[model samples]
Every structure is written in structure tokens, then in C-alpha cells.
Target: MTAPLLEPPGGRPLRIGSRTSLLATVQARHVAELIHEYAPGVATEIVPIRVSADVWDGDLSRIGGKGAFSKEIDRALVAGEIDVAVHCMKDVPGDVPLAEGTAFGAYLERGDVHDVVVTRDGTPLADLPPGSVVGTGSVRRRAQLGMYRPDLRTERIRGNVDSRLARLNEDGSGYAALILARVGLDRIGETAQPQEVLPLEFHQADEGVVSMVPAVGAGVIGVQARQRDLAVMSLLGGLNHDQTARHILAERSMLHELRGHCNSPIAGYATTTADGAMSLHGMVFNRDGSELVRFHCSGSPDDPAALGSEVAAELLRLGARRLIDATGG
Candidate 1:
């Protein structure tokens, strides 16, 4: 049996590497607190590192969107600079990359995987004033928003959650509303106060789900100590959230089959139901969501990755490949 250890390496203060942003720190601290609670003797610490990705000089295209943020932390892990690296699962890419013979280990309880829209005055998106400005950097979000409000103006806004929130003004000068992910708001404890919390089903990324796209091999975050460092892995095993792993597998598999990147207008999400089966919702769009094509896969659900692959295959057959190739996705 793959029995997990009750406690991590004791007496040694384990360092958890993470970005310095408020959201990143909060997530890192949460994991640290859990470890301290589980193993009283095991000390914990947090290391803040700066990545070039966060220094947005107005051009998000060159700074390397999501992967740029994770590659540095992953390097630190490889060098054993930290016992483990804490990360937002969505920021990671689809594949896991480590020196050959190495592998990613575990993940945390997933946050709201869906995306949400934040409009002014707690009003539903439909109620937003005509010509409302919705801000987001995700091609998926923009495409979906365009589908709903053909007249609405969508702009690219980047920065930490708070940074983006700062741009939402009391005066109407700023964008009427900002489009943000629900999980991020919840993590920073700002879920309720932020303007209109657009329902996700219609908004694409809603409350209760996170649109995950982890850097290759970054989906898992339990720990990556060497084989000789079994103690660290043992301690991290206790922190593992099995359902989180399943969701990562299902979501990442869709990206893998589709072979998408920042440019690719491909999107996918996986959900675990009461019956313990998985449901996958996927879509591929052109520059505009008007040409959007979506489909869902349902089956034993135990084979989430397989189900995701099957869906990608179907999309490719349905001309998704031609769409991507033609659009430079």
C-alpha cells in the first residue's frame, strides 16, 4: 500500500518557496500553517523570490505570461533551495518538466475553478450599463465575454488581484467593471465586496471552480525532495489533496491533447460529481468567441485524463486543428 507518513522531517525548519505577491503569500502561508498544525515539531518558513514575469512593462506578451512566473521557482526546487514550492495551480502549464528521473508529487485542495466577472454595484452583468468595460488578460475570458456582450469593450489588465482591483474606480473614469477569477477573490478574502460577482456558468469561469492551466509538471506541490530526501516527501504526502490531483490530471490532459499555449484559444475544465465521476467541459475559439465550439465528456469519470484526451481528439476531428493552425494558436 502507498501509505503516507504521518509527519515530515522533524526538527528541520522546511522552507516553502513562493512569489511575494499577496495572493501567493496567502497561499504559501496556508500550506505552512497546515504543516505546522499537522507536525508540531517540524518548523516552517517562507522564501519570497521575484520573477521577471511580474515586472510588467506594459507588454505581457514578451514577459512570458504564466510559465515565466513558475520556471524560476521550479529551478529553486531543482537546486534544493527550498524543500517545496507553493504555487497557484492555474498558473502552472500543462506539462511537468524536471530533470529526467524526477517527477512532481502532490497538490492542494483546489479553489473555485470557474472564472467570475466583477461588475459595479453587485449588479448582474446583464444589468451593467451599456458599453461597460470588462478587463481581463485571458484570451478565453475575453472571447467568452465578447460572445455575451457584443457591444461591451474588453481590455487587457494585468497585475496582482489587488493591483487590478485598484484600477476599478469609485468614479466611472476607470473601466466600468473588471473580470477576475472567483478563486483569487476568495483566496484574498475579497469575494463579496467587489462590485458585481458575475455568475460563472454564463461567465465561463464562475464561483466554485478554477480554470486551471499549470506550468508543465507544476500541478502537484506537495514536495520534490530527492529520493534520498524521503522525509520531505513523506511530510508533503500528508498535505496532499487527492481530488486536487484528479482535477489537475483531467485539466492538464485536455491541454496536452490540444497542445495549447498562451496564444492558443483553447480552454478546458474538469469537475468531479457526487457519483464520483468526472465531467469535462472544453472549448476552442477563434480570436472572437462568436465562432466558439464547445463539448462535454461524460463516462466512468475515473479515467479523467482518458476522457479529456478523447474530447481533444473529437475537437481535432471537428476541425479544431485547422482552426488553431489558421489562427496561429
Candidate 2:
């Protein structure tokens, strides 16, 4: 493995690799601001990297799923071209482990993790006209929405946040509602009021009970660095949020245990309880949401990985692997 320099050659600012999307640049700037706040006088520059997944024309699953978004940035890190890489945690796939010598060094504080329904003129999801079309790119969102509201049609929509919103805002766009991540909308300052902020907690609905379990590692920003870059990692450590790191670590561990792919509808979330115990919940669903295998476990905060693994094992025993195979997840 190539050992990255302790400092950039010629005293150049440390390069932080980020995706070229607007939302990604926003996240990159946020992290840069935090870095500047924590470690003053450390010159840093945001280096945008174009990822294949961002430019791919076909469905995400066919192009290698969410991991595709991070591969190039990770390559840049491994190649010593960048000191660190910033990524939306949800886009890092569970099946593909980080490259050797690279480690997740810090996690920003958690943000709003729930998905939301944004509609033209702000029509509530339930109140939308019957047979109305809803747009989203996530299979998990599609399955859940179908289960929650079978009367509505779920269609695949793709683009950066602004482009997707444009499609929704344009007159006669044919979409009654759009499912989007609340954090993404908030990050970009898009104030299209959410028709409904889907709750994570279970509740009774007209089409039976429903809950919106977030994608694993959702609402978190991950800072990755070369393991040997002690200087960079030390600087990043100052920006780490311990509580958020614990939660994301458990979530990622569960994802690794599940080995769930992008093609599968897998959701996992971890949080602390009132007494400070760490609890993890993992769910696996069939394509149509007809069958679900859900499991939960709690453990000491110090051993969050164990808690996540335990819950994942239980879900697997309940046929999670079967669903994954059936759906190529």
C-alpha cells in the first residue's frame, strides 16, 4: 500500500475529494466548514470527483448500485490523490467493504433521517387524487409506498435534487407526489413543504399498519481517510460526533452482516434508548412488500457492533437471505 504523505507536497492545501453534485458540494462545504472550525490554519480544498454512478444512464442496480457513487472517490483516497473523502453514508453499499488501508475516520452529527412526500401545491400523500403517480428512485421507498398506498402508482425518477424538483414543479409534470430524503431537501434549501413526513415509529393507517425505517447509515456524513494518515485522521477526529458515530457504526455493521445488496429492500436503524442502551432494528422486505422479516436487539453502547450483528442474524434466520437472493439484493 502507498503511504500518503503526512502533509501535502509543497505545502499545498489538503485535498478533500467530493462528488460534483450540488447536494454533494453542499455537504462537502459543510464538512469543510467544520474542519476549518476545528482546526484553524489547516489549508483545505474541495476536489470534486465525477463518479460513474452519477452519470450512468441505466438503473442503479445494473450499474453496481450505491457503491458506484463512492468507488472513484475511494480510489482517489487509496491513490493518495486526496487526503480524505466525504460521502453520504446511505450511498455506501453494505456488500462492498472499504478498500484496504482506508478507514471511516469521522461521522458528522445525525440529521433528519425520515423520508418525505413532496407534492405540487402541497397535496398530502393520502389526499392525492386516486391513480396519481408518485416518483422516486429508491426500491425501498417504492415498496413501502406501494404497501402503504396501493391506490397510488410508484414510478422511478432519477436526477440531482434540483432536477427532480424541477420535474415535480413544472406544470403538467404528471406526478402527484415525489418521495425524497428530508435531509437532502433541507441541505439544498428547497422549501417545498412536505405533504407528509413519514414517521419511523409504527402506527395504524388505512392500508394496515406502517412504519418508515430509514436506510442504513442515512442522515450521516462519513469522512474516510487512509489508515496510515495519522496526521489527517487526528484532525478529523476533532470533528467526530461520538453519539452519531455510535449509531452509524451499529447501522453499518448490521448492513455488513446482512450483506444486503442495492437490489434488495433492506432498512436498518440504530439509536439510543432513554436509559442510554443502544438498540438496533433491521428489516428485509420482498419486492412487493408482501413478506417482511424484522428483528430488533439491544446491547451496551460500547458494543454496538455486536448488537447490530445479533439483530441481523435474527433477520437472516427469518429468511432475509432468501429474499435477497430472489431480488438479487
Model 1 per-residue lDDT tens digits across residues 69-147: 7777777777877777776665665544443333455587766554566755666676667787878877777776666
Which residue runs of candidate 2 sit more than 4 Å off their true CA positions?
1-6, 204-210
Candidate 2 residue-wise lDDT at 194: 54
**lDDT values, one for every candidate:** 0.66, 0.85
lDDT score at residue 252, model 1, on the 0-100 scale: 77
Task: Give all TM-scores, in the order shown.
Answer: 0.84, 0.94
Q: Write the per-residue lDDT of candidate 2 for residues 264-294, one digit (tens) a residue.
A: 8888889999999998888888886667788
Alpha-carbon runs more than 4 Å astray in model 1: 1-12, 57-59, 95-102, 170-173, 199-228, 326-329
Q: Flag clash pairs in model 2.
A: 261-329
For model 1 the local lDDT of residue 22 reads 89
Task: In angstroms, give how far residue 281 of model 2 lies from its true place.
Answer: 1.4
What is candidate 1's CA lDDT for residue 220?
34
